[model samples]
Target: MRPQENYMVIISPGLLVQLMERTGDGRSVSVRELADAAGCHPSKIDALRNGRREKSTIDEALAIAKRLGVDLLVLWEHTGRTVPVPAEPPHIAAVPA
Candidate 1:
């Protein structure tokens, strides 16, 4: 199996927490601040940060990457290395099963 195929990769919760901690703007920012900037809800950010959520959409991930000032692909690569998400997109049918 290809490396991407064999490994299931995802961004770690700690990474998000670390990013939030590193913001260092003096004034405390709520999860909403980060999530809104990242185009998602505060709860979503909290979920991801606390490990209550497992996965996020590509758009959501991209938004977070943008807010973090990192390339989306690079973040994905890092997440893939650390979390090992599925290399290939899952197959889904238009028609309901």
Candidate 2:
């Protein structure tokens, strides 16, 4: 993968910041450190932290939630975040006469 070309996950910066403040163990962590721990780029973390992103993959979200000691579903719900996945259409098999 090329630099700055990684698939970044979107997330709610406000919610994340809230969670971090509430649960960050009183430890000040940098964006680069968080990104390193989350297996993403610092820009991705910064984007999510600064309200520049809106969506995130399950893995990334889970990692972040774990770091903040918050439940993924709970945080997602609090953030008003919804999955962008389209509902799978029902399959209809053709019947031969």
Candidate 3:
């Protein structure tokens, strides 16, 4: 059976920062708050906001977008890059004695 491949999800640092800016009602959103809402680590959000990180898992991206009240495509996008899944080793037939 062929293994499922994975693709890269690019997160726009600028867009993420912008979205985070407007997250709180009249107030700025904190990294910890956003992280909690997104079910991720605060450092993850900080990295994405500061352009230190550009990639995220689809689930993470979706959670972040949902928490920010925006569509997933608004801040995250799928890239052409794909990680191929490793195939299993072939089975060898033993010679009968």
Candidate 3, 1-97: lDDT as tens digits: 6564343354567877777788525446778988897788998788778765666667777787777878888776675545332222243223546
| Distance from true location, Cα of 14 in model 2, Å | 1.6
TM-score per candidate, chains pooled: 0.57, 0.59, 0.66
> Which is the winner by TM-score between candidate 1 and candidate 2?
2
Q: Tell me which of candidates 1 and 3 scores higher on lDDT.
A: 3
Clashing pairs in 3: none
Model 3 has an lDDT value of: 0.68
lDDT of 2 by residue, 1-97 (tens): 5343112234456767776666657665567766776788887777678765555556676777777776776565322234343222244223546
User: Largest TM-score belongs to which candidate?
Assistant: 3
Off by over 4 Å in 2: 1-12, 22-24, 77-97
Judge candidate 1 at residue 28 and give its lDDT: 41
lDDT of 1 by residue, 27-89 (tens): 445688778976877877897788766456676777776676556654444344455453332
Cand. 3 TM to true fold:
0.66
**lDDT to native, each model:** 0.60, 0.59, 0.68
Candidate scoring better on TM-score of 2 and 3: 3
